[model samples]
Target: MSIKLDYKPVVVLTDYMYDSIQPFQDVYDRAGFEFRPYQCKTAEEIIQVAKDADAVQVHFAKITKEIIDALPKCRLIVRSAVGMDNIDVAAATAAGIPVANVPDYGIEDVSTHAILLMLAITKKFNILTRTVQEGMWDYAVTKPVHRIQNRVFGLMGCGAIARCAAKKAQAFGMRVIAYDPYLKQDQVNDLDIILKSAKEVAQESDVVSVHLPLTSETKEIIDREFFGWMKPGAFLINTARGGVIQERDLLQALQTGQIAGAGLDVLSQEYIEKDDPLLQMNNVIITPHAAWYSEEAEFTLLTSAAEEVVRGLNGEPLKHPFNKIPYAKQL
Candidate 1:
């Protein structure tokens, strides 16, 4: 007897997510499945686009319970990036849809970006650039810069990015410290990074970098109390999720000189309609969440996500399965 295989429709969610999907277009085409790309800007649009899709490729867009319930045919939700916090994982699981992500896609790129942010802030690069651009030679000379050597560098989460940052910091002759309850002492010791409590990391470090995922326990993790514990004249660098640090509190901290400065690659809102408080603060540097946006990282992310999709289609185990439930439960 001969058996026939069915090719399911795979939907690419939005324009912003297309760059990661474009590279894999040929792969999907050759796999004998229908590839549908939609420019969905809202949750309603996402539901409509993914309504008949067998798998939906998603980015930072919201994937609510209503959308998940609407997508009756969606067998998988493939996230182009590592973070799955934007998607309603529980709802997807209930709907019998497995979520897949590309977790290791941007580790080196993001870690390098974090270190760049730290170095820029420590040396007052942004201020110096503005002063020079305005033709104020005296202002450029007035700005003071600090060396990285012998300074204490703290990491909030000892994940891939944190580990990468620790290694880079050590190479620069900085003392690296990290606080993560999930990490074993032996593991931390092996990295040659100091293990400290969250409060202690905040208090003792001259430069603090946040690398944790955003969860209920970590949301607004850096607030007034957290900032209060930091050493005076220290710098804060956040290459992690935006919500991890409260924007309003950060503005106040900057205005009050609570800390010397900050380098932020992510924000609570990507598209701010009005002049945000953070923008008004001269001491704060902001990037449009481009920490994981390097060409090399984008290629890795694209290829990784594509491989996951192909693996799913082939009925094989995914390289980065976001949810791995029991087979009995899945059935």
Candidate 2:
């Protein structure tokens, strides 16, 4: 007797991630599966599209419990990036839908972006670039830049991105230190990075780069007390999650020169209102959460995430499953 395989449709609920994953169309086609792309602008629309999907390819789209409940046919929910806060992992788990993410997809891109922010702030590139563009050559001569070499760089999280940042900082002739409770001392020593307390890392480093994931514990991790612990002219670079740093406290720190400057690629809100204080600051550089967005990174993210989907469909074990929530243990 011959057995028939059940091929289900994989719906992609995203904005523009379809374009990124276009290269993998052949892979999906060869697998004898239907690939449906839907641009879901709201949570409701996501639920509607995901209702009949066997697997979902998600990006920044919010996957709430409502959507999870609606996706009765969905056995897998794959995120294109590492962070799964946008998805209701507990609900997915309860629904028996495995959720995966591409954790190591943009390691170099993210690390490079963090370092770029650090270098830009330390060298005052933003000011210099604007001054030169405005034909203010005299200001450049008067306001000289600082060298990155011999400076201390601190990482708030010692994950893969942080480790990559440490390696890059060393290449630029800077000393690297990091603060992470989860990382072992031997691991830190192996990377040749100084392991210090969070307070010490903040106080001593010439430039502090935040690489921690956003969590209940890490939300507003860099608040007033954090700014107070930093060196007077120290710079800050946040290419990590937005809520990791408190915007109000950061604004006050910049206004009072508590910190020298900041290069931020992410914000607590993706689209801040017009009157937001961060918009009024001249010393701060803000990008629209594009630190992880590079041509190379996008390609890697799309290809890797697509591969994960294929793996899940083939009943193979996933390489980057995010449905396992350690924080859930507390509840």
Candidate 3:
């Protein structure tokens, strides 16, 4: 699509949970462009609102191929979050629109959340707190709780967040081991984390934490087979995508005593039914996909996403490019 000489470039935000868009507006104002925010849930809605947009900053809205094809002037597509699964990156690349994401904004917050989950589940915080609130002052209500020190903590994917989690676990005197085929032993040598095979990590760890992105290859990667490998008393933590572990398998594992407990920050489905079995289980701790949250992180996420739009408009390289494409010519 050719640009119109008289046309003013516009940036569209498909959706956002923020109470204010001022962070985005500030960046767009300095760049001298229009910043439009819309709560679009469907491709048709996005197409109608962003047809003339020079860039699109998306948060949770699915930027499908249909929406991508409709944006004739779209030079960039930026996901406000770390994962690009919500946006069709391949479609954007084929259309010569580079896709970017804010990957670094939530590193500390998410890693910290992972550690929180670890401690809460291992310490039986839920059971103890609930029993106490019920006027039962017996410590025996949370019987069989174990110490964290010197226990094996296995990580499924040793990315930045997992590495940070390792440091936190180490501070509590836990031994950290990880399994990530993408990394070599030398890469993690400085951190003192032992790299092991997936099976070995599952078999040896007192707690197995998942830190993988949701992709075709990783969907349901932690299923019955992996659970079978885990010790019957071992715990499981997943602050990453929920689809990484099969929910049915996880429930079965928790029921049959194959695994002790689970701490989940995300789910395969965002909304769980009121009577979901996972919620009924006392051994489970679930958060509302809020691992990547903090007042500071929120500001950083919005600012970085807006900056990507500015970079695209200025023909500058994206700080976190998800796809490679020829830079769009300046208007």
lDDT of 2 by residue, 1-331 (tens): 1112653546564555444557456667766667776778998888776677767888888888988887677778888888877888888888777888888988888899998888777777677787788888755542546788999999999999989989999999999999999977887787899899999999989999999988878999999999999997898999889889988899899999999889999988778788877767667777777788778788788778777777776676777778652111100
- What are the lDDT figures for the candidates, one per model? 0.80, 0.81, 0.90
Following a full C-alpha superposition, what root-mean-square deviation does model 3 have from the true structure?
2.0
Give the alpha carbon lDDT tens digit for every residue of 129-243 in model 3.
Answer: 9999999899887889999999999999999999999999999999999999999999999999999999999999999989998888889999999999999989999999999
Per-candidate TM-scores read 0.91, 0.90, 0.96
lDDT of 2: 0.81
Which candidate ranks first by lDDT, i.e. highest?
A: 3
> What is candidate 3's CA lDDT for residue 97?
83
Question: Which should have the higher lDDT, number 1 or number 3?
Answer: 3
lDDT of 1 by residue, 201-320 (tens): 999999999998888889998999999998878999999888899877877788898888999998776765457777666677788788888788887777777667766755666676
Candidate ranking under lDDT, highest first, comes to 3, 2, 1
RMSD of each: 2.7, 4.0, 2.0
What residue runs in model 2 are displaced by over 4 Å at the alpha carbon? 1-6, 17-20, 139-144, 272-280, 325-331
